[model samples]
Target: METLYDSIRDKTRVFERTGVASFSETENGVQVLTDNGKRVEGSILVGADGISSTIRLPAKYRALVGTSRNQFVENPKLPFLARGHMHNVYYEGISGFCVQGVQGLVFWCLFFKEEAWPDPRPASKFTDADCESVITKYGHLRLGTHYTFSDLWQSRVNASMTVMEEGMIEAPWNRGRVVLLGDSVHKLLPLLRRSVSQLPSREELAEAFARYEAKQRPRANICISMSNLAMRFETQDSWWLRLARRLVPSIPEGAWMPFFVEYITSAPRLDFLARESPVGRAHDLKSR
Candidate 1:
C-alpha cells in the first residue's frame, strides 16, 4: 500500500482530516466545500467514501480485522510462514481467513453474524477491550494445524472492528460533475476496482460516468452475488453446505487451475494504457 501511495504521490494532491460538506457544479468545473471551511476546485468529484458514503445501508455482519507483528521473526516456536498464501476455515456461523503478508506480517479477519443496524452509519470505533472480547470468544479456533486464532491475536500490532454492509445503491451514480465510486455504490465482501477521468462539459462528464457505471455495474453485481453465495456456504447451517465444506479439503490443487486461468483471461485492463502481452496458459487459451 505504501509503495502504491508513493507511486502516485508525486502526481496527486491529497487532502486528509477533512470531510465533504457540500458540492456544486460551476460553469467551468466543480466547487467543493470541506468541513474545515476550505474550498477546492476540480474538474470532477469522485466520492470514494466507502460503504458509509451518501446512501447508508444496514450491515448484516461485523468483522474484526488486524495486522500482527512479524510473527515468524518474533516467535521462533511458530511454524514457517509462507508469504501470499492464505489459511482459511469455515465453521458453522463463524468463518475467517489469515494470511502471512509481505515480511511475515500476519493479516486476518473474523466475521460474526450480527443484527442489522436500523440506520446506516459508520461503525462505532472499537477499543482494545472490544478486540480482547472477540479473541476470548473465538480464540480456540485453529487457522491450520500449527496455530490457533489466539496465537495471531496475541502478537497484534494494530486491530479494528467494522460492520460489513452488503448491498448496492440503485440510484443514479452521478449527477452533474460528481460521481460515486467504490463501496458508496456497491458494498460487497469481495474487492472490485473502477476508474474515471476529466471531460470538457457536464454532459460529457455525465456520459463518461454513465459509460463507467454501465461497464462496471455488471461486474459488481456478479461479485456481490458470489460474495453472498460464499457467505451462505460458510455461515449457514444447511446440509448441502456441510457436504460442500467437507468436500473442499479433498479437492486437488489442479482442480482449481481452470478457474485461475479464466480469472486471468477475464481481468479488466486499462484501455487508455499501452497494451502488454499476455503470458502462460491465459495467453495460450486466448490464442485459440
Candidate 2:
C-alpha cells in the first residue's frame, strides 16, 4: 500500500484523518465539505469508500441486501497473514482472520444471524464472556489441519463480533458530478476478493461513469449470484446441498478444468482497450 501511495503521490493529493460531511454540485465543479469545515473542489468526485458509503445514498433509494450466518468451518489463513505481507482470511461467513501491525498476532471475527442475536448492537456492546460463549459453541470446528476454531480463538490477541451486510445499489451510479466507485456502487459477498476493475478512460466524466457501470454491472450481478449460491450451499443444512458438499472435495481436481477455463476466458473485459497480441503489438495493427 505504501508503494502504491508513493507511485501516485505525484498525481494524487491525499487528505488524511478527514471525514466528508457533505457534497454538492456547483456551476464551477463538484464541491465537498469535510467535517473540519474545509471545502474542496474538483471537476468530478469519486467515492471509493466501502460498503457504508455516504455517496451511494443519493444514487439509489434502496439496495438489495443479503447475509450469510452459519456454523464454523476452517481453512488455512491467508498467505499474506505472515509478516511483511498484509491481508486477511475470510472463511465463508463463519469467521475472518487477520494479522495486523504486530507480527504473529492474529484476529478472528464471528458474525451471528440477526434473528439469533436479535439486538443490533455494536461490537463494544458485547462482553468477553459473550464472545467466549460463542466460541464455546462453535470452536470445535476445524479451521485447518493445525488449528481448530477453538485453537485460534484461544490464541487470539483480540476478537470481535459484527454483522456482515452484502448488496448492490440499483442503477444510476452517478448523480450529476458526483460518481460512485468500489463498494459504494456494488457490495458483494466476501467469497470473491476482487473488486470491479479500473474505470475506462473517457474525455467526459459522465461518459466515463456510464461506461464503468455498463462494464461492471453484469459481472457484479454474476458474482453476487454465485456468492449467494455458495453461501446457501455451504450454510444451509438441506440434504441435497449437504450431500453435494461432502462429495465435492473427494472429486478429482482436473474434473472441473473445462468449466473453470470457460468461466475465466469468458470474464468481462474493458472494451475500450485495443486487443494485444503475444508480442505486445496491437492485434489489429491500427493506430488509435
Candidate 3:
C-alpha cells in the first residue's frame, strides 16, 4: 500500500489536505470544489476514493446490504500451522470467517448474511454493544483446533462492523469530463478478493473506460453471483444444502483436479494495455 502511495505521489500531481466537496461539469471541463471552499478545474475527474466515494454518491450508486467486522489478535502458533507462512485462512460456517496473519498479528473477520442484520443502518451506527452481541453469538466456534472466535474477540484491540453494498454503475462511466473508477463503479463481496484493475493511459481515457466496462462487467457479475451462491450454500440451514456442503469436501481430490485446473487456467484477464505477443489465445484456439 505504501508503494502504491509513493508511486502515485512521485508520478502525478497530487492535492494534499484537500477534500472534495462536490463536482460539476462545465463546457470546457469538470469543476471541483474543496471542503475549504476552493474551486479547481480539470479535464477529467477520477473517483477512486473507495466504497463510500463522494463521487459515486452523486452518481446514484448505493450499497444494498451486508454485515462485516474485522478484529485482531496475537497467535504465535499461526506461522507454524500455515506452511510457507500462509497469511489468509478462511473457515466455512453458517456465515464465513477469515483469519489473516499479518505483521505478527492475526486479523480476522465475521461476515453475516444480510438477513442476519436487516436494520439497514450504516455500520458506523452499530454500537459496541451491538458488536459484542453478534460476536458472542458465534464466539464458541473454533477457528482451528486451538483458537476460537472467543479468543480473538477477547484480545481484540479494535474492531468495526460494516455493511457490504453490491452494485454497479451503468455504462458511460463518464459524464462530460467526470468519470468513475474502482469501487466507485462496482463493489463485490470482500471474500472474492477482486478489485478493479489499473486505469488506462491519459491519451486513451475515453476508449479505455468503455473497454474497461465491457470487459470487466461480465466477469464482475459472474463473480458476484458465485459469491452470493457460496454464501447461501455455507450459511443457509436447508438440509439438502448442508448435506451437499459436507459431501463436497469429502470427494477425492483426483475427482476434481482436472476440472479445477481447467477453471483456473481459463479465468478472465484484463487487457489494459496491448500485448506484443499474446500467449493464451493459441491454446484456446487449439482446444476449440
Please provide TM-scores, in order, for all candidate models, with all chains considered together: 0.64, 0.54, 0.55
Give the alpha carbon lDDT tens digit for every residue of 1-288 in model 3: 255478784554566667889998766566899999989887668775543344322221111121212222454334322422322223343444444445434455665443445344444465676667766776676656665566666766566665544556666666444556666656631111223434334445556555666666776776556555555564543567767866887899999777645645565544453678857664464265
Candidate 2 CA-lDDT value: 0.52
Q: How many steric clashes between backbone atoms does each model show?
A: 0, 1, 0
What TM-score does prediction 3 earn? Answer: 0.55
Residue-wise C-alpha lDDT for candidate 1, range 202-275, written one tens digit per residue:
88878778887888777777667666666666564467886888887899989977776665566564455565
Per-model C-alpha lDDT, please? Answer: 0.70, 0.52, 0.54
Clashing pairs in 3: none
The local lDDT score (0 to 100) that residue 168 gets in candidate 1 is: 72
Question: What shift in Å separates residue 100 of candidate 1 from its native position after superposition?
Answer: 8.6
Off by over 4 Å in 1: 1-14, 50-58, 62-89, 97-109, 116-127, 142-148, 155-166, 187-199, 237-243, 246-260, 271-285
Shift of residue 15 alpha carbon in model 1, Å:
3.9
Q: Counting only residues 3 or more apart in sequence or on different chains, how many pairs clash (N, Cα, C under 3 Å) in candidate 1?
A: 0
Q: How many angstroms is residue 123 displaced in model 2 relative to the true structure, after the best TM-score fit?
A: 9.7
Q: After superposing candidate 2 on the true structure, give the runs of residues whose Cα lies further than 4 Å from its correct spot.
A: 1-4, 7-13, 51-133, 140-148, 155-165, 187-203, 237-257, 268-288
Cα displacement (Å) at residue 102, model 2: 21
